[model samples]
Target: MIELLGKNLTELQAIIVEAGFPKFRAKQIMDYIYKRYIFDFQAMQQLPGNMRDWLTTHCAISIPEIVTEKTAPDGLTKKLLLKLSDGNQVETVLMKQHYGNSVCVSSQVGCAMGCVFCASTTGGLYRNLDTHEIVAQVLLFGSLLKERIHSIVVMGAGEPLQNYTNTINALRLLHEKEAFDIGYRRMTLSTCGVVENIYLLADEGIPITLALSLHAPNDAIRREIMPIGAHYNLENVLAAVKTYYEKTDRRVTFEYILIDGINSSIENAHELGTLVKDFPNCNVNLIPVNGNEHIQLFKPSRRQMEAFKNIVASYGVAVTVRKEMGDAIQAACGQLKVQHAQKQSE
Candidate 1:
């Protein structure tokens, strides 16, 4: 069946016209699916019975099944392990914040970046998810909350830029007026230095925030943890980020995961501050490494984290430590999915 959720109005119009229906039927269908959050054609009472029957036969609104869900003790963070049609599961996180609700969606079944501290790459790369799969993640969470999802972070499970086309298409789908209608500025796409794709995205003129996973200060230290840093070094990645800023004027966020005694030293912080100090619009987000059994990395002490942040701030660069949330539930990216998979095997 054709997955209709990810298709834009133009694509939907083509599908409707090809299926022996007027172009206007596409708008009607979008209204039912997006505005009403109705997926089943049989439930769309406005559409004619014959059209509904035809839709039921030819199209499907793909929504991932929630195989497992865990909510943190704070009751503000929830993570879902969603099972796709082919049985591969991807994790999506719902974070309830004082500002608004945000959802973190995964772009691929498993990651290929091979970041040593990440749990998503534990099983190696599986495959890039289709646009529908990516978009379905947001819709699933949106439907569950029955409220607006204020922001979206493409920072879960997989490398979004690696699945470039689908990631872009999914973002567009989510931004559509008929759909979630999230503003471009509120959406953030995190990449592990996919320099070419970063350049391509800059050319695309999308106003969304671009976040770089710069776990370490220099290439030597970065390559030791994140293999992708070897090919796309910090210098090249920053150049691409400069192009992105010039093109979109959007402030880029550098995600620095502080691993205890590894990348959390004050010297490392100073090196990172120097690297980004000249950028026109940039912010450094320091994240203490989240615990994972598969990875031996440990989070730095609160004093260590604060001292490191102070050094980066002293370089005349904007820096902030990311607020910890959902730690009790293992809400860190890829942790829940990995644990769930392990349980199934046992």
Candidate 2:
């Protein structure tokens, strides 16, 4: 069945016309669904009972059902297992921040990126999520919390850039004034350095922040953790990022995950600085590494992390260590989905 909730006003109008309803009814449906967040046709008071019944029979408004929920001790992070229509479950995380509640949405049932440390890519790629499924994740999470989300990160279970078109369409729906109306700037798209999509996203001209999962400063270390790193080597990835900056005029955020004795050295920091020194607008964000079970590396010692950051900064590269959030709940990126998949397979 076709999904109705993710369609924008213009697309909804086309669907309404095709469904033999007056085109004006599309705006009425939009008001009920987007403005009121009501999916029940009976709740659409403006629509006639007959029309509501017709809509119910012809269209489906899909929302993921909560299969499991784990809340952190601090009461700030909630990890949810969302069972999709196909009975496959994907994970979404609701994190409470000082600014407001932010949700991370998954873009695929499984991932193809195959970042060795990430469980989402472990069993191989399953299938890509449609635009509707992606948007539903945010709506379902927000509806349960009873608080409007102020920001969203497409950095959950799947590599969003791998499913480029649908990911972009979902982002568009998320920002629609009639729907979530989230500001484009508040939305971040995190990629594991998909060079082509970086250029594609820049060409779209949206000012949304772009995050590169640059776990290593150079190609050799990256290939050890992320197999795709071999195909898109550091040379090519850095050049693509340079082009992206030129086209978008936006500072790219390079995400560096610090693993003990791995890519956490002062030399690695110097290499990082050299790679990005020319791009004055970019910032390198240091993430104390998590997901040690999949990867047998410990989080860097505070001293080591600080030393690395200081060295990079000494080279005139702006660097900041990302504060850990929802650590008690295993809400550190990719942890929840990995746990859920293990349980299911057991």
Candidate 3:
């Protein structure tokens, strides 16, 4: 099926001309897809019956198929298991905030970056998603809500930088005024320190917020948890992050997951603070590790988390404990679709 969702105006125009329709008709279809967020061709009453039939027959306004949706009791978070055309499932989340609705999108079906603590990589890599599929996830959720999405976080099942081309293209399509109309600044891309992509992102200068999954400050601990750290190391990752800040004039966000006695000690906090001391503009986002029944790990107590934040704060590093979302439905940080998939297979 032909996917019309990811096409820009020019591409849509070309499709219309090729289909023996007037070029102006493409603008109408674009308006329906973007401005109206209409997925079913029948909803577009302005189009002639023949054109609608033709477009519906030849084109697919594709969106992710929801296999299941689990809404947390808080009513602000919904976790979805989406089945792609190939029958491979990926996760996307709709998070309701006072600011507005925010959606998190996955770049690949599964992840190859073997971050030991993550479930996305436990299944190993399947394949990278196309630009169309990535955009479809956003369009699927945004269209359903009928409200503008205020933010996007590319911190889902896969490492976004590993799928850089498609991720960037999807970002561009999502930010298009004719599409989801999300601004570039509202988007955040999280990476597990894929050093080269940091440099590449700096060259592009898209002005999206950069979130480094710096679960640990030193190379030793990071390497133990994240396989990528073995190759790039903490020093290399920080260097690239600094380069990114130098080029974009934007502060990087270091995501540190407080895995109960693993990387949550005061010593680690001091080390993390010192690591960011030179980069005073950078901020630390402390995340409480999300655990499951299979994993005996536990989330840190409120006091413990606060102590870590205060320790970093004392070093003059701006830091905040990231608010946990979808906890009732087990949607905390890495506990979304990944854990579910593991449960199903077992």
Candidate 4:
């Protein structure tokens, strides 16, 4: 069955016309799926019985099945392990902040970027998720909450830029006015310095925030933690980030995961600060590395984190330590999915 969840209006129109239905039927179907959030065609009482029957036979509004969900003790952060049609699973997160609700969506089943501290790549790469699968993650969360999701962060599980086409298409579908209508600025796509894709995104005209997983200050240190750094050097990555800023004028965010003794030193902070000092619009986000037994990484202490931030701030660069959330539930990306898979296998 054709999954209609990710198709744009033009694509839907083509499908309707090809199915021997009037062009207007596409709009009608979209009204039910996008506007009303109705997935079952039979529940769309406005359509004729024959039309509904034909739709039931030819099309499906695909949504991932929630295999498991865990809510943090805070009661505001929830993590979901969703199973796709083929049995592969990915994790999505719902975070309730004071301003609004933000959903974290995954772009691939498993990750290829083997960042030493990240649990996502422990199992290695599986496959990229289709556009429908990516969109379905947000829709599934929204359906459960029965409220509008304020924003999305494509920072879970995998490198979004690696699956560039599907990632961009999914964002477009989510931004469709008839559906979620999430503003471009409200969306953030994080990449592990995919330099070429960064240049491509700069030209795409979308104003979504581009976050780079820098992790370390120089190529020497970065290459030790993130393998992607070997191919795309720190200098080249910053150049691409500058190009993105010039093209879109969007402030880029550099995600620096502070592993205890690896990249959390004051010297590292000063080096990072100098690197980004000349950039027109950019900020550094310090994430205290999440602990993963399988990965053998330690989280930085509060004092260590604050000192590093102060050092960076001294260089006239904007910096903020990411607020820790959902710790009790293993809220970090890939933590829940890996644990779930292990339990299932046992």
Candidate scoring better on lDDT of 1 and 3: 1
In candidate 4, which residue ranges exceed 4 Å CA deviation? none
TM-score of 3: 0.94
Local distance difference test scores for all models: 0.89, 0.84, 0.84, 0.90
TM-score of 2: 0.95
* Model 2 spans with C-alpha error above 4 angstroms: 344-346
Q: Estimate TM-scores for all models.
A: 0.98, 0.95, 0.94, 0.97
Per-prediction backbone clash count: 0, 0, 0, 0
Candidate ranking under lDDT, highest first, comes to: 4, 1, 3, 2
Residue 85 of model 3 has an lDDT of 84
Error of 4 at 244 (Å): 0.4
Residue 80 in model 3: lDDT: 80
lDDT of 2 by residue, 1-346 (tens): 6689779888998998887889999888876765567888877889988888888888888877888899888888888888888888788888898999999888988888888667687767888988988888888776777678899999888888889999999889889887888998898888998888888988986778888899998889999988889889988887888787787777789998888888888898899888888774889999887756546767889999999999888878889998887777777656777787788799
Candidate 1 segments whose C-alpha is farther than 4 A from its true place = none
Which 10 consecutive residues of model 2 have the lowest summed lDDT? 289-298
lDDT of 3 by residue, 14-66 (tens): 98899899998888887888778877998899999999999879999877788
Candidate 1 on 173-268: residue-level lDDT in tens?
Answer: 888887778999999999998999999999886799999898899999999999987798788998998999899999999999999978888888
